[model samples]
Target: MTSTTERPEVEPARGGTHASGEPADDLLARHRAVAPSWTSLYYEEPLELVSGSGNRVTDSRGRTYLDFFGGILTNMVGYDLPALREAVTKQISRGVVHTSTLYLLRSQVELAEKIARLSKIPDAKVFLTSSGTEANEAALLLAMTYRRSNQVLALRNSYHGRSFATVGITGNRSWSASSFSPLQTTYLQGGYRFRSSFRGMDDDAYVDACVADLRELLAVATAGDVACLIAEPVQGVGGFAVPPDRLLGAYKEVLDETGTLFISDEVQTGWGRTGETFFGIEASGVVPDMLTFAKGLAGGYAIGGVVARGDVMDCLDANGISTFGGNPVATVAANAVLDHVLDHDLQHNAARLGALLKDGLGAAAQRLDLVAEVRGKGLMIGLELVGADGYAPHPAAAAAVLEQARAGGLLIGKGGLHGNVIRIAPPLTLTEDEAREGLGVLLTALEAVDAAQG
Candidate 1:
């Protein structure tokens, strides 16, 4: 018998009403006509998510799915949680929706205080934005504005944002340089041991080698020229790669030696997602001068922010400001998310659930020929798929797996430099049983894809 979890919520599989109470093909055709092709990459026919509550989202076709992707890791609180809705409604009724950094807003102050308290960064100051890319853009601008320098160092395969400044710093040539010229920045390759290009490397050796390469880059990079080094603690889009335990300290020392600011882009890794207090520099016991955040901040309530040390933030205070960056409604939603994560001990849950998922995925990968490896911690996970033959991207197969999983009543995501990595970033509220269900669904999906490929 098919597992209950694998059964689609839509009944009579054919001619069924959608979650939006509309025909699925009609909705898909409308979207295909009105939306950009890029958006349609993930939104094929019969795609219409209409409602969400907790970890399940219902589509227009009345198909409910276990949302292991967590709305691309933004819905940390799941969907329509009463607390978040109430917080947003209260803020809206208060009639304080729009405000700039020039004026002090109550929600702004409260959210700032809560973030500082949670992060434990002394004299932490915040800059609010509308999205993670904007947060990264602001961080890069701030770093550039503060430094008496022109050069910045970023790791290869790292994702910062898409704005000109942040895009210049993003290391992926496929996503970045192919469309734009390199800005005033240099790329220093750094990441995990699995398939790392750097040779003669162990954990310590990787750090030492990266540090040496950075020193050389600095020497030729014009002293007082490199402004900052931005990196993710655990690589998310880069195949959920985790660095060696020693890379953080070693790189921080290199920055210290060069008097360069260190920026931690925690947009994808922050909140309770990593089973930590905050996706701050403290994860690796290294303190960054600046940190960028978004995604899980407002629990899918449209908020992003930056936390910087006093000295670094002072630079922004002296030279810059924003409008509508810290709208009261968004901040209130952010406060509610912070409260919910704390009150429910979501961080601990993330840690426990992550362990369960990772172990299960590892075993599944070992039993499956299509899977190359499994990596990630906490709720952030990735499964790298090996090519069936030549070195071509297996996007077709990956899409097949995603489609099969969707049909099986699970919502998953795709990632990696090649789009072949199955990303499993669920809400922090995910339970062990939910993880098991998702894993089983994904395993069955993989088998279907393999069989189709054969």
Candidate 2:
């Protein structure tokens, strides 16, 4: 007799058909009718996820996948945990679901305190927002205003967010939606080197070269009239491109000399997902003057936040308020997430399991030439697919692997400028057996695609 949570991947006990019982094609058609054309979705036949438990999610068609992507690294604690559900339900029962930021909310204040303490910035001040875009928007405002410059510097192959402001700073053209940017953005080299002139150089040498380039670019491009240098320690949407250790530190040295600010966008890489440290940027030994977070921080609640040096955050003279920034329910959930992460020491789990998963993928990449590189720290891993020629990006291989993994009951994600890097960041609560199972499915899918392509 198996437990209720236990279900075969082929035959989920519940959630087989859409609530409306509409055909899958009709459902997609209905979505297309209401949604914008540019809204990206996964798969040839997009999966309609209905319910989840632990690391597995059941689709509308009664199939359960070992969810490796964790809802784009948002579901850090996984789905349908009793502890999480009960806490949220109790909060909802207390009547104040959303009281905005007008009044002092205990949950919100508690969350702020935790984040401030965790944030490396001294005398930190935090502002909550509804999403990463909003959090980053807040950071940008602080930096530009504090420095009184609209000019910003970001790394090539980096993604901040989707807003007009962040899109201006975003260097990835694929994720950049609009041409009109509010900031005069100067793109730098160094984060992604899959096709970089800095390729093949040793790590320290590469960092030195990139720092030198940044100095030259600043001298020539903006002449050091920049407000800040915003970067992700591990380039998340740009395919988990882990810059060499101290890369940002090297950049910070340059920024500090010019009184420029540094902002770390840890939306995907924060909250111990990077394993070795509390934040992904920690591995770089660079404490950003401003830090932005979202995605997995609030246990899947809609929340984003920015932490800044108190003086910088308070520099703005105008009165400002994010109406629904730290809603009560979301803050409660965020508090629970923090407690769980700290109590269980999931950071160590991430490091241990991340090493196991990366070892497996690295071995697969070594054996199968289809995979060009297996890079990333902790659980935020990426497997970059390539053509038979080895360097050319093979997005088709990535696509095939995604579909193949889905059919084989595993859900992974793909990113990168060319969309050729498979992103794998599962929940921090992922079990060892579960990690191995997902890894097996992923390797099989990779091998299947490699053989089919050959």
Scored by CA lDDT, what does every candidate get? 0.78, 0.90
lDDT of 2 at 395: 93
Per-residue lDDT of model 2, residues 1-454, tens digit only: 8657765343222323463474334566667767999997899999888889988898877788899999899999999867778879999999989888888899999999999999879999999999999999999999989999999999999999888899999999899989899899998875788888889988888999999999888988995669999998899999999888878999999999989999999998899998999998888888889999999888788999999999999999999998889999899989998899899999999999999999999988888989999999899999889998999999999999999999889999999999999999999999999999999999999999999878
lDDT of candidate 2 at residue 218, scale 0 to 100: 91
Clashes of 1: 7
TM-score of model 2 relative to the true fold? 0.95
Which stretches of model 2 miss by more than 4 angstroms?
Answer: 1-25
TM-score of 1: 0.90
| Model 2 lDDT, residue 295, Cα | 97
Poorest 10 consecutive residues by lDDT, candidate 2: 8-17
Model 1 Cα lDDT, one tens digit per residue, 406-426: 888998888767778788899
How many clashing residue pairs are found in candidate 2? Answer: 0
> Residue 60 of model 1: what lDDT?
68
